[model samples]
Target: MNKNKALFTLTLVFALLFVWTVAEAGSSKRRGTAGAMELLIPIGSRNLAMGGSDIAGVSGVEAGYWNPAGLSQINNRVEALFSYQRWIGDINTVYAGVVAQLGRIGSLGFNLSSLDFGEINVTTTDAPDGTGETYTPQYLTLGVTYSKEMTDRINFGATIKLISESIMRQSASGLAFDAGVQYSMMDEKLRLGIAVRNVGTNMRFDGPDLEIKVQPPGTEPGAAQRPFRVPLQEFELPAQVELGLAHDVVASESIVWTVSGSFLHNNFSFDEYKLGTEFVLNEMFAVRGGYVLAQDPDEDTFYSLSEDFIFGPSFGFGLNYPLNATTHLKLDYAYRMTKFFDSHQLFTLSLGF
Candidate 1:
C-alpha cells in the first residue's frame, strides 16, 4: 500500500538521523559556546517526569514543546495546560499551552514559556559591593505548532518559536524551528521518534547598557565625553537532535507499563543517554523513574559528582481524574536529583475537552 511506503521512508530517514547523531556525539569542543541556552531546558511536567524520554509518547498541548508529532494524538476537540517549576538557583519557570483540532486536516498549538530570574543587586567594576539598584532578567519563548497524521502509522509536525531575552536594558531576540516525526508499528506496541530542535540564526545583545560615555585618551581635561558602544560577540543557537524509542511492555485493563530510551546529541555540550520507565495502575495513577548517563556512565561516580553539573536520576508520579465522557483533568509532579545545590521539582495541570 502507499501508506506502507510512506512509513518505510520516514523510518529510514529517522534511522539515518539517529546514526548521524551518534557519529557526532564524540565532539566535545563546542561546550558553552552556543547562546540561548534556555532552549535546552525541557518544558512539560509529563515530559520531564518521563525523564525527557517522551518524544515517542507525548500528546496534547504539552507536545508543543516535547515532540510536536505527538500532537496528532489529541483526540479531544480542545486541550489546555498550565505548568510551574521551581528550577535551580531559585529561578521559576511558568508555562501554558492550548491546542485545537482543525477538522480532519490537522491540529494547531500555541505555547508560551517564560523564565523569571527575580531581582538581583546591580554590580559594576566600580561598585563591586553594591549599587543599591536591582533589576530582573527575562527569557521568554512563544511557539506555534502544527501536526498531522500522515497515515495510520506515521505523523509529522513542526514548530516555529520566537525567543527573546532581556536584562535591564540590553536585549536580544531570535527565531528557531523544531521539526519531528513519529512512527508506530506492530499495532502501536512499538514507537519511534526523531526531532531536531533550536535551529536558527545567530544572535547578539545590543542596547543602551552596552553604550558607555567616556573621555577619549590623551584628550584635554575639558574635552567632551564621547559615546562608545561595546560590540557584543554573536553566538549560535544551542541546536541539537534527539532520537527516542518506546514500547508498551504490558497492556491490560488494570495495569500498563511502558519503557523508553532516548539519545540526545547536543551541539553545545556532551551527548547523553536516558532510560525511563512508567507504571500505570487502573489508568488513573502512574509512577515514573529514570536514569541519565552524561557521556560516559563509568565516569559518573561520587568522586566526580561534585565536578559534574548535570543530574543523573529522577522520580515522579501523576494522577488523572475523569470529569465526564469528553473531559478529564490530569495532574503530574516530578523530582530530579542533582549533583549540586538542591533537586528540581515540577508541577503541571492539564485539561481535555
Candidate 2:
C-alpha cells in the first residue's frame, strides 16, 4: 500500500482499539482489584527519571518496557542494558534486556525482571508472633518484543510477556500482551506515541497450602476428618492505554532540548498525567526531570492533590562515553520523591555495538 494509505489504516486501527479498551476502564471503584502489580513497575533509570513520559522518544533496549516501538530506533546493530532499582518497602528490583537489529526485517528484544521481597517470618492464626519459619516471595516477568519501521516516520511493535508470582507454597502465572505505534512529523522534530499495556488472562493462586483438614459439623466423635480445598477467586491484570507527544524545542549542533508529555487511562485506578524535559550537551552529557500527577474524582480540577500520590517529582543525569569506533557505554542514575517511605533510587548501565 502507499505510505499515506498505510498511515491512515494504522491510525484507524489504533483509534478503534483505544475506544474498545477505554470502554472497559474502571474508575476509583475498582482500585486495588488487579493482580500481578509487578507488571506496572518501571524499569530503566532514564525513563523512570522522566516519570515515563518519553514513550515517543525512548529508543534501544530500554524501550522494551516504555514503548516497544521505539526499539526500531536503535542506532547500533546490538544493544544491552541492565538496571537496578531500590523500590519502596525495602524491595529491590532488577531488570535486564537486549535488542538486535535485523537487516531488511525488524528489531527484536528480550527482557527479564524480578522483584526481591526478602525473607519474612511465617505466621498463622495460632502463632501471633512468629512461627520460626521464613519464606521468600518471588515475582518475575519475561517478555519478547518485535518492532519494525513500517514507513520512514511510522513504527509498530508488540510484546508478549509471561508473569509469574509465588508466595510460600501457592503460586500464580499468566500471560500479557502489549502493542504500540509511533509517528514522527515535522522533520522528525515532533513525535506521537500510543500503546496498550498489560492486557491478559486472569490469575488465581492454588497449591498445597490451600488444603486443610476439617470435619463435618454433625459427624460423630470418632468420625474421620477430610481434606478440604479452599476456593480462590481469579483477578484481572492491570491494563492501561497511554498517549504521548514529544517535541524538540531547541535542536542545534551542540545543544538539544526536548519536552515530552503523556496521559494514562488506567483500568483499575485513577488516570495520570506525566510531563518531562531533557537537555543534552554535546551528545555526551544529559540531564532530565519530570513530574507526575493523578486525576481527582472529588474535585473538578485536572489534577488531584500531590499528597495523595505515592510518587512525585524525579530527576537524573546520564553520561555517554565512546569505547571504540563502533562501541559506546552509558551510565545513568535517578532519584524519585515519594510519600510515607524512603525515596526511590536507580542505577542503570547500557552498552551499544
Candidate 3:
C-alpha cells in the first residue's frame, strides 16, 4: 500500500463508485432497469486479442481473465480454457478456465462463466396472473489465482472470488479481490502491466422472498417487508483499474509480433480504452486485431468520460495451433462492437506443458 498510497486509494475508490453510480442512475424511477444484461457481461476469451495484451500479455489458462500477472507465464502442468458467444441474435455466452502448476509452490486457477436468456415465462396478478414460472438467469464465478516469477523482469499476482446471481428468485452472493503486476522488456521484447480490480463488499439479498409481503387481507398495521438493495447492485465486483502495454516482434525463427494497450477504471463505467495486435505465423499460425472505447481513445488519459453506450468502435480476429513440443494446443477468436447491443463473439481453448 505505497504506490503513492496505492494510487491514492485507487483514486478514492474510483471516485466514490463513480459518484454513487451516477447518483443512482440520476434518481432512477426504473430507468432502463439499472444495467440489465450488461450486454452479456462483456463476454470474454482474452477479448480474443480484440483487446490485445488482455491486461498484460496473457499466458496459459488464459491467465484467469487476462492478468493474474500473466499467470507467471505458466510453467504448465495443466492449463485449459473454453468459450463461446453468439451475440447479435438471442445473445448467448459460455466460458471456462483451468490451470495448475505447483512446481515451486505457486500457480492455480479455475473459472467458469454462464449467461443465457433462453427461458422466460413467469408472471402474476393471481389469474389476471400467468402462474407458470420458467426461469433462467444465473451467473456464477468461482476463482483462484496465485502466481510468482518475482524476478528476471518482475511478475506477481493474486485473485480470489466467489460470486453468484440468480434471476427468477432474486439471488445474490459475494466476495472478490485481485491484484497484478508484470514487466518484461528488451530481449523478451517488451511488456508492462498493472491491475487492481474488484476489491470487496456490498451484495445484500436475502432468502425467503426477501420476506414477501401483501397487504389488505385484514387491515394489518404496516412497514414490514424490506430487502430492496438493488441499484446496479454489487458485492464488490466490477471495480476496475487496469493499465497495460505490450510489444513483441521477433520475426524470424518463424515470426512473432504483438502490440497492445489498455486502460480502464470503471467502477460501474466511464473510462475505457483498448488497442491490440498479434501475429504469430509460425509457432503455429495466428492473427488478431483490436479496438475498444469508453469515449473514443487509444491514447489520452488524465481523466474524462462519463457515459455514452460506453463509447463505440470495437473489432476482432483470431487463430492458433500447436499440439506438440512438450505439449501445446491453442485456439482463440474474438469480436466486439456495441453502441446499442448486437456485436460480441469469443472463443478460446488452450493447453501447454
Among all candidates shown, the one with the greatest lDDT: 2
Question: Relative to the true structure, how large is the alpha-carbon lDDT of every model?
Answer: 0.83, 0.89, 0.62
Deviation from truth (RMSD, Å), model 3: 18.9
Deviating ranges (above 4 Å) for candidate 3: 1-55, 58-91, 94-114, 120-131, 136-166, 169-182, 187-196, 206-208, 212-249, 252-254, 257-279, 282-353
By TM-score rank, best first, the candidates go 2, 1, 3
Tens digits of lDDT, candidate 3, 235-319? 3345565678787755567888777888765555445677877777676666677766554222343332223443244455445
User: Model 2 TM-score?
Assistant: 0.97
**Model 3 compared with the native: what TM-score?**
0.31
Scored against the true structure, residue 231 in model 1 reaches a CA lDDT of 98
Q: Write the per-residue lDDT of candidate 2 for residues 1-353, one digit (tens) a residue.
A: 69899789878987887898789877567778999988888888887788889899888887888888999898789999999999989999999999999976999999999999999999989997889999999999999999999999999889999999999999999999998889999999999998889989999999999999998789999789999999999999999889999999999999999999999888887788999999999989999999988875435345433556678899999999999989999999999998878998999999999
Better structure of 1 and 2 per lDDT: 2
User: For residues 1-353, what per-residue lDDT tens digits would candidate 1 score against the true structure?
Assistant: 89988877876776676675556443446567889988877777766877788688878887877788988788689989999988888888899999899977899999999999888999989999879999999999999999999988889989999999999899999999887888887899899888888878899999997899999999999899999999999988887788899999998899989999998777777667778889999979999988777663234433222355457677899898999999989999988877665788989999989
Clashing pairs in 1: none
Q: What TM-score would candidate 1 get against the native?
A: 0.92
- For candidate 2, list the clashing residue pairs, or say none: none
lDDT score of residue 300 within candidate 1: 42
Candidate 1 regions exceeding 4 Å error are 8-26, 296-306
Which parts of model 2 have CA positions greater than 4 angstroms off? 297-307
